[model samples]
Target: MTDPVRVVLVDDHVLFRTGLEVVLGADPRVEVVGQAADGVAAVEVARAARPDIVILDLRLPGCSGLECCRRIRDELPDTQVLVLTASDAEDDLVAALRAGAGGYLVKDGDPAELVEAVLGLREGRSIVPPDLAARALTDLARFDRQAAAGPIGQLTPREREVLALVALGLRNREIAARLFIAENTAKNHVQRVLTKLGMSSRAEAAAFAVRAGLLSPS
Candidate 1:
């Protein structure tokens, strides 16, 4: 038989963490190896246990979920992160993905789906909601059309391509693969696009893409 997936739960709420331990522990294929009440402890436990997957919360006391995700990706490259958050804001989702989260799930999601998402991550697949995916695609398309006709029409085709992907919630590495460019090259293009558009972050780019009708509404 295959080994069970090792998981570490991280959240600020003690009650929530306890409840999750009970639920996830009951699964035959999942083993709850550790639990942390905040991001700091989460990182420590993750490093110690070296779990296959880390179930992380978006908001914590010491460090935010986005920062935590970045740290986990850097420190535990082998472990996948699945984000569980109460916020469904597009910006938050984009931020989490950019920080290297393998999955993004709202708190209201069914327990079964959450477990399934964790299993899917273990199987090497990401689990983003269908609605979020549709929204991302719409944002990409909208950004494309607007950039084609806007004053910034001077942006080269390649820059426009990078812009659309950025608006679609893709990270540098993912965009690099999709565009057939080096990761550093992708990062450079994203930086240039942000500078040209006077934006500080990808979230701003996404919002601009949406407001400009560069993306279709889902």
Candidate 2:
């Protein structure tokens, strides 16, 4: 049998965090491994617990949830992050994605949807509310086009192929499998692609690909 998904819950509100814990814990498929009430503590707990996913909040007290997301993702690349917050602002969603969060969900959604988002992250999918997703793509595409093109034109043909797949939201492991390469090799390719493109996150890389006409929105 598969192991339950280990999760670290982070939010400043005790009642909300506790309620989510109970809600998510009721699901046998998920295990609440750790909890934090602030961004700094969230990072520490995540580092120590090394859970499968970190459920974060944007308006964290010690630091912005976006900062914590970046730290957790940068320090623990194997652990994915999902932002669960009350803020539905487009800037917040875009920032969270750009900070390397695997998914974003507003607090207004049903608890069942939260469970589904957690499971979706386990399956290597990015989750966002339907209401925000379309506008997000349009805004992301615009952001990419307006940003100065870095060394993107310097990428080799193979690297371009990888970037296109990234734009399609393919993770490194999936990219490796599709291209018949080692996962580590795929990871290296992705890192190099980001370096050459002067982008910090896969979300940005996808936008860059779209702006470059290497990928279509459809």
Candidate 3:
């Protein structure tokens, strides 16, 4: 049998944290390994627990949640972060992604989504609330279109090609088939594109591509 996924909860609210523990605990596939009431203890508990995922809140005390997220990711490269907060602002989402969070969800969603988010992160999928997605993309594209000028120049010709295909919503396999390259090579190219662009995920990179006219605007 597969081992249960270990998770750490980092939120300041006692009632909320306990409620989350209960919800996640009901799923046999997940195990709640630790809890932190603030940003400072967040890092310390996460390091000690060494969980597979850390569900953090953006509004934190003792230190900002962004700093905690960044520190934890820097200190533990293997552990993924999932931001669970009440804020649905695009800036918070962008900042969280920059700090290495793998998923972002607002507090008002169904509890089942939280479970799904945990599973999705474990399976290497990026998660964001469905409602905020379109707005986030268009706004991100507008903002990044300007910022991408300097960073976009950093990408090689081949990497630029890869970014365009990625913007077209092609998966690594499809990109490989289209370019007559190995799937792993396509994946590597995608990663290099994101890294050079200083973007955290394919979503952000794709938005940049759309604004730059690399992909036809839909």
| Runs of candidate 1 exceeding 4 Å displacement | 138-218
Ranking by TM-score: 2, 3, 1
> TM-scores of the models, in the given order?
0.66, 0.81, 0.81
- Candidate 1 deviation (Cα RMSD): 7.1
lDDT-best of 1 and 2: 2
- Candidate 1, residues 30-134, lDDT tens digits: the string is 999998988888999999999999999899978988888788878997788998889887677767776878778898888888888888777645567878755
Write down the TM-score for model 3: 0.81
Quote the lDDT for 115 in model 1: 84
Of the two candidates 1 and 3, the one with more favorable TM-score, higher being better, is: 3
Tens digit per residue, CA lDDT, model 3, 1-218? 88888999999999999999999999999999999999999999999999999999999999988899888988987798999999998888877877888778999999999998898777555677656755666666656556667777898889989999876657788888999999999989988888888766665576567667676655
User: Candidate 2: what lDDT?
Assistant: 0.84
Candidate 3 residue-wise lDDT at 32: 100
Every candidate's CA RMSD: 7.1, 2.8, 3.1
